[model samples]
Target: MRVLRKRMDKPAHLGGVLRDALKASSLDVDLDLYRLWEQWTDLVGPVIAQNARPAAIKGKLLLVNVSSAPWMQQLQYLKSEMMEKLNSALEREAVKDIRFKIGPIE
Candidate 1:
């Protein structure tokens, strides 16, 4: 006697599968961080945004580039507040800390 076997269906689009994989591996957080960089101006005020640029995200720490040493120093002082604002805006603890560096903003 022969037995019948059931077959699994495949996703219509690869996009969904890839997105699911990314979420499963927690890579979606990195994408969210990229989005945060794009919306930096809106998240922080124009003044601070103009002087600073979100360079990268490593784990829970965010690296920011400031146009001048003064701005970098200022940002160092405001790091905690910035983290609070960013995490609150994201509705998650995406950013636990921020590091400010004196570099080219653009």
Candidate 2:
């Protein structure tokens, strides 16, 4: 009679495994963008956050949906400030510019 043994491999850290998976799926950037969206209220404060919502991120540009045209116009004036705030909150230059359009907030 013969006995066989199975080999075991070293375990990878959870963070490293998650990083690898995100990279493999090209989801790292998407995840970061989603984080920005998720943290919109916390980053921009309740007033702005209530009037506008992050719609998408294309390259360094951020698309925002504003509740009304007046709000969109107001946000346009605060574009640079908003960008700085969001980037500061993210601890990275995730968003460079913001484009606001009048659209449904919810």
Candidate 3:
């Protein structure tokens, strides 16, 4: 007669496992971008959120679409502040700079 034994492994939290997978797959930045889009209003506040929206992220630069030229101009003055807020929320320096373009948000 022979006996067989099975090995058991500890389970990891789903969020942490997904985050690790993203980091390993080099899609961590994409997750960060998704977070930015998902939490834009809470991250930046309703006013900025209403006038500006994240369009894309290239390297450390963040491209934003503003509702109007005046809003774009206004956002220009708040670039550094916004970067600080974004990076703080992301828990990393994923967004280093911002460029605003006049465009429809949708």
Candidate 4:
């Protein structure tokens, strides 16, 4: 049993460890995205909830739906400024753009 334990501890068998590290990194990315989505939506909720719904995409952009053309136009004007504020708040460049769409609402 002692010899078997020594063999099992060999550093040459680190392939499994490498795979686990990759998996953990992937999971970390997923969790980060989820948290950013939750935080950003919550941050912008009151401002846009009545006028839009937003989703985070690829950690680089936010897709928003506006119920009216006027709001869409307004949002377009503030896009970059909003992105800067959001990225600053998130402490990372989590969003580089905001895409607006017309919502299916009267």
Q: Pick by lDDT: which candidate is best?
A: 3
What is the TM-score of each predicted model, taking all chains together? 0.73, 0.73, 0.75, 0.56
* lDDT by residue for model 4 (47-73), tens: 665786664354466766788899899
lDDT of 1 by residue, 80-103 (tens): 888888988777898888888887
Q: Rate the local accuracy (lDDT) of all candidates.
A: 0.83, 0.84, 0.87, 0.67
lDDT: the better of candidates 2 and 3? 3
**Tens-digit per-residue lDDT, 9-43, candidate 3:** 97779999887888776487677778899989998
State which candidate, 1 or 3, has the greater TM-score: 3
Task: Please report the candidate that would top TM-score against the real structure.
Answer: 3
Give the deviation of candidate 2 from the true structure as CA RMSD.
6.5
Quote the RMSD, in angstroms, for model 1: 5.8
Q: What is the lDDT, from 0 to 100, of the residue 38 in candidate 1?
A: 78
Q: For candidate 1, report its TM-score.
A: 0.73
Question: After superposition, which runs of candidate 2 have C-alpha atoms over 4 Å from their true positions?
Answer: 1-26
Regions of model 4 farther than 4 Å from truth: 1-37, 40-42, 104-106
